[model samples]
Target: MSRQELPGLPTEATMLRDFPWVVVRMRCHFCRRGGDARLAVLAAKHGPYVTMGRLVVEFMKECAWAPWNPTRRPQKYGMKCGGYCMDLRRPDPPDLPPGMQGLQLIEGGLSEKLPAAPAEFERRKRVGSDD
Candidate 1:
């Protein structure tokens, strides 16, 4: 079946809340192309009322994993070629939109589900801010 045909293939947290193993694809909000443009999904746990939380999706890329060079944002370098690289945050807090209500997702789609952001990178974000 095609990616989208997988029901929750390009699964949303909401979809995963119902179905476990699902395959889906997500398009890049920055890229305005079609086809494999959507190469990610947001998988979540299934439930009745509606389980809310961050959805963890899976992604597969054909690039050499690089260790944060402490000076690269990955995206800045063309050498860093790969799949999803951002978290799918909610558009609005409190509650999701009508369509988003049934679909648990925010941004980045499945590609958003990474092992974890580099600690150093996070540290930089709070360089001057108070904890």
Candidate 2:
């Protein structure tokens, strides 16, 4: 099936199917393109990635498409790569299942089963933040 056919979200996470494996392709929020990989999925992957937190950190760590050097961000050296150089891009958070209730997901249609953000006021904000 095409990337669009798969549910949940791309590289960030996907709900485990009855099958053994899943191919993931998460888009870069910056460059807007991403590489694909095969991962062993088990369950829902939670996120506050849009606000850039642990979920974003783990996603970047796991994503094969991310740059290796954390301190020095990528620069296009005229197609030349060196000294931990690689592409620079951030992984967007994957969609959550109905039970967890995602923060910024699009609702209706295919996502009809998905619920709105949590009713508890605290749940609406990032897990740990002064904001």
Candidate 3:
């Protein structure tokens, strides 16, 4: 399904600490490999701030069908891993009020513009040494 259809699904920026479940249950249909990971243990190993998307990638690394698995046989038309989290299929939560939706408010708000890069540094092409 397209990402737009899965509006309730967590985005790449969704941190591990923000996940709804205490334990993450992941299964790979291709390898028949599955496991339950405690949120606390995962947070300790990967940090609470690590994104769910990143964890998904890490979790699928060992699967033979995983596209990014370097040790897997090089096949031009191999099936991709069907690894996924079980908790992700939970019913979507009720929508928040309009005012409560969107980006979280920062303490000081964001800067109007980014700081300009140094022109001298941009022009330099030397591999080493200040000169």
- List TM-scores for all candidates, in order: 0.20, 0.22, 0.57
> Which candidate number has the best TM-score?
3
lDDT tens digits, residues 80-125, model 1? 3234423233233223357765755466866767766555553345
Report the lDDT of model 1 for residue 7.
47
Tell how far residue 55 is off in model 2, in angstroms: 7.5
- Candidate 2 per-residue lDDT, tens place, 24-130, comes to 44344544445544433313444222221223454555443456636546777522221111111222333336567546655568656666775666447777898
List pairs with backbone clashes in candidate 2.
Answer: none
Query: What TM-score should be assigned to candidate 2?
Result: 0.22
> What's the lDDT for residue 64 in model 1?
38
Q: Which candidate is the best by lDDT?
A: 3
For candidate 3, the per-residue lDDT at 121 reads 53
lDDT order of candidates, best first? 3, 2, 1
